[model samples]
Target: MFTDEVVDSVSIQSLWRKSQQSSQESRGCQTRVVHSAEAEAQTVSATISCTQTEPQYQATQQLFPNHDELEPPGLKDFLQRVEDTVIRELVKNAKSHAFDGFQVNWEDHSQLVSCLHCLQHPSAHERGLHVTSVSWSCTGSVIVCAYGRIDDGDWSTEGSCVCTWNLDRRALNPKQADLVIDVPTAVTALCCHPKQPALIAGGLYSGEVVIWDTSRTQDPVLVQTGMSVDSHREPVYQVAWVPMQKKGEFGVLSASSGGRVLIWTVDSDQGRLVLNSAYALVRQQVPHSSSSSFKVSLRIRENTVTNQSTLSEMYFRLKTMLVHVLSLSLSLSGEVQIFDLGRRSLRPAATIEQGDQGQAATCLAFNCQNPHLLAVGKTDGTVGVWQLSTDLTEQSPRESAQLEQIANQVAE
Candidate 1:
């Protein structure tokens, strides 16, 4: 059986065969129409316009078919009679002094605005820090600038620094600062001490208030709030040095966006601030008189200003009426209300509807040197220096009588 299988395998191997192949060549052609890129081009333009205007009042024109027939009577005689009188009056008026020095000036004399200085800090500038606030020292010889972010809303732990320059210094450098105080966080507000030129009060983005004594050589921070329970939980927008009960000593007054205002005194021994008093602004607790037209809500946590003057102005976001605290007068919508702080009434003492109810006032300052000069900072970023009307600021003999009448309002 093995021998027969070997013979059959050799026969099958001999039968393995292959097929042959052939090759041919062919060609075809196609025609195309193409335009030339290097060509001469020409362009033509034509325009036609016509305008014709006829005499106006043609329809109302009364055709004088009989011009001589409708001639005015005694026109020559009337002219002769008034000619002498008109000439005499004209001659007399020309010699009169009523309008001799009068002139109409249609242009304003205050033309160019003066830019004093363009100060900068290289370290803060290189780090892309924005100047949040600026203040002038009491002597007016030095200016301080606080570095922070204004466009960003997110919380940042990025360190901040305050740069100061002595304008009276011979080597005043705009590219560099005379003094730089490194801070722990971004500064939101800065104010130089009204009396002390070396002291500066600042509010930070981290809801802390810091007092920096620039006169100090090593430790610039005199006192600060370090995450204490009595400290502000929200970012402080405003910080001012308010006069304390103790003579010659000042207290720190800070207002936050959370509607809380706290006052603190410097405790240098412990390097901390001691809480003196606190005030919170609440919408429900607001005394709404009947004179108020539209409702208002206390929403501004980003801006606040305080000083030692009797005049004060408050600003709210939505209300057209300026949320002001003045015993003199206030206006909402179109009515000006004169109220008393001592009396508790739902109605105002007197209402004057004919008062200025224009755009709300934001912040203001009174010149202690010049009582008439009042600088008002508006919501539109324009500061208006108003001269108080003599009739308003001037004391009148009838002021007492007017107070008595308001105290006993017989009319409802």
Candidate 2:
């Protein structure tokens, strides 16, 4: 046998060379076995080298830089790199389908208005009034329908029309409304026809529905009233115009305080317009056990002539659904129900119970491009979005399979 010191020195050098060779062959392969005899020889060599001179292990460590110390960076450099990574991630997220947010730029402030407060006419009510419902005329003029208590201890009359500065004119032409329509009771809901210009339909506190012709200055040409012997028992809460088909019959849809949805057909018989109640789409009880007395309070009070709230509500709700009226949505008890016009049935589309449940849904709107994208406003001044995608059915399986394969590969 060789001297112990010489044997140990040779073994250490052999072990280092073998390690380098194995690394060079396959850096990623972690399972290559080392011969036990070779390892023993290398250990013996290391022991002999240590005995013969100042420990070679210490010298080797000094020769090879410590990875952690060599790669240390200053605070500024580290922060800059982090910021760059964050910016890149943000850009990628914005381009991805997962990101949803509003992006718009307005140059002129006057072009928009908030409907937070309903402007007051001094002679109409002693305390003026707050707008209960509002609708936009065909010419882009605002039709503020106000309802509030007058000084006379009686609920003031309903269906008052106040025209603000015409937005189409692009100037502040604000003026007190000279035109007003006194209905049987306070108007609870308002809707404009999709095809007919200057035509408005409203549901009233007296459980009646009325249509107004803005072209005529006098009282609304009551096309059909719902207070008849066979009218909806409960007060009407919401009204919507059916999306006019590109080439088909035109109609209107109305939702009642009693959870009844009705569809009507408008026909012209020898220059005389006849509104016919055609179908009762849905007539289910409100799902929530809360008092049916729940109503959405308009943020606009009389004497506060701002259109911001109204415009924003309209922009998010009405404008979103202008593309396809096939479905109608309302949030009840934090659950969104979509009414299919074709099926005439209610379908629970989505549920958003993450936020305050007590926050009643004030308004709901749909995206123009995507019918499944809905924007909902709550009574607590919060807006939430729900995105529905049919693509999920196709992509989910493939994504799950891909993830499983990645995990399996990592395990092996």
Candidate 3:
């Protein structure tokens, strides 16, 4: 999936404080990935050596009980410890392997590095700026920004807008955005189309999902609302595009804070992009005529209708496809729940209880190199890595081979 520009070697630099003795003291760490000339080598490794200059402090506070505090007191201390541990681990791993080595002078230098570019909103609002979400286009040429924050006092959707910038043209023309669409609701989540760079999906605070065509951003290309169809009641927190299962079909999955996940499909019919189907994330018990305890409610076009057996069957079909769905939810009590959209029950497949000391997970990401490896970041700057294991027999031979290849590359 990488183009020549992307496959080229790149260097990454991380900045951190040099020691606890001084808050102003800073150091830069850089790592470069270069291609090896050996035909037999599929991967290359490097060893970096850096001297530690400062003493680390110990954690002074105990882990707070879940019910004992609304906010954790030891969070800052815990984060500092995590940072020191990370630096130590990086140095250790760099020295353990040897493929090629280069020296970088870490001596403190006081000089300014030129900023390559900058992006800003065309119009400023009375409210403070809080870019809650951002996503890059598939080709990496465009960037989409969403604006809003629940914590912002006097927050309103009046200033909330979705803007896309063309990186290639920005250097030559820095005054205006490539595309700007005023959204009615505060955009909380954004996801670019995996196949189409021009299509951008945005989730709003009003529980609406709007798809904007960046090519012409004055208005949204498609809008899905809860009033017209089934949707989330709470703010949509995340929107992600699912891998396409069929040819000429596009699927998107969105998750809201109200514990709702909706799978939406879009298709072009008669030269118009239309919503083909929307399946709500819900659970229903199989109905029995002899039992009179069956109750059903569905929202349709601003009206709620009560029905029983048919809707239950529809939910059953949705549950059957849960294997392809991976939804994550975090509780204020420091619990992380992973829901399987393919399961028949609404209960989570696995739950990670963060006993007293931990805070709610703030972010989550799956490893591109290994899909089964998941990493979550907590509000306190603590990160947890979880491995999603499956039976060996469950994986096809092609998948098994790919896993083995990745293992060999890591070993190298």
Models 1 onward score TM values of 0.48, 0.38, 0.41
Candidate 2 Cα outliers beyond 4 Å, as residue runs:
1-120, 123-128, 139-165, 168-175, 243-249, 267-412
Give the distance in Å from residue 375's predicted Cα in candidate 2 to where it truly belongs: 16
Write one digit per residue (lDDT tens) for candidate 2, span 15-74.
887898878753454777866653333333333333366598888888986766755558
Top candidate when judged by TM-score against the true structure: 1
Those runs of model 3 whose alpha carbons end farther than 4 Å from true positions after fitting are: 1-115, 153-159, 170-175, 267-412
Task: Report the CA-based lDDT of candidate 3 relative to the real structure.
Answer: 0.55
lDDT of 3 by residue, 53-121 (tens): 443332223343346556678887889879988999999988884433222324221111112334446
Looking at candidate 2, the ten consecutive residues that score lowest on lDDT are 311-320
The per-model lDDT (C-alpha) reads 0.62, 0.46, 0.55
| Model 3 Cα RMSD, 1 decimal | 33.3
User: How close to the true structure is residue 295 of candidate 3, measured as C-alpha lDDT?
Assistant: 40
